[model samples]
Target: MMILALLGVLALAVGGCVCVVWAERGGPRWVRVVATITLAAGKVVQYSAKNRRRGLGGSNSADD
Candidate 1:
């Protein structure tokens, strides 16, 4: 069951990557929307990690 769930998530991630590439090449409207969402999600994850590091007393030299 866990393997199946992991595979499902992997499939979604692959699909999102394909959508991102397709959108960059001027694919359909829906693809563009998906790509935008995927990018935004990546940014959110990045931001969350950064903040988490700061909360844990990471290096203060890192730029915001």
Candidate 2:
């Protein structure tokens, strides 16, 4: 069901966060790999959000 899919995504996000922390402390090669992937995913999300915001008029003020 949809709830199960959402739970799985949340689990992966948490695991990736753990890997990022472990990698920063010089963990094993696999942890480092996962951390790199996690970072890339974060960058992609940030870039997508920025683009979406720009498309929406690039304004953060409410008194527009």
Candidate 3:
């Protein structure tokens, strides 16, 4: 089950990449929408990882 879930995630990532490329070439409206969603998701994941790393440093304050 875990393997299947991982595969699903991989597929989605690949599809999003494809959509981004297609949107760059002005493929279609749906492609642009998908690309936007994909980019937003990537930003969210990046910020989440940064926050997790900061939390791991044992500092709750953002001054660090």
The alpha-carbon RMSD values of the candidates against the true structure, listed in the order shown, are 4.8, 3.2, 3.5
In model 2, the worst 10-residue window by lDDT is 55-64
Q: Compose the digit string of candidate 2's lDDT tens values, residues 5-60.
A: 99999999999999999999999999999999999999999999999988777465
Assess candidate 3 and give its lDDT. Answer: 0.94
The C-alpha TM-scores of every prediction are 0.81, 0.87, 0.87
Which tens-of-lDDT digit does each residue in 1-64 have in candidate 3? 9999999999999999999999999979999999999999999999999989888776746456
**Model 3 residue 33 lDDT score:** 97
Ranking according to TM-score, highest score first = 2, 3, 1
Better of 1 and 3 by TM-score: 3
**Residue 61 CA error for candidate 1 (Å)?**
13
Candidate no. 1 TM-score: 0.81
Q: Tens digit of lDDT per residue, candidate 1, span 1-64?
A: 9999999989988999999999999999999999999999889999999999887664556543
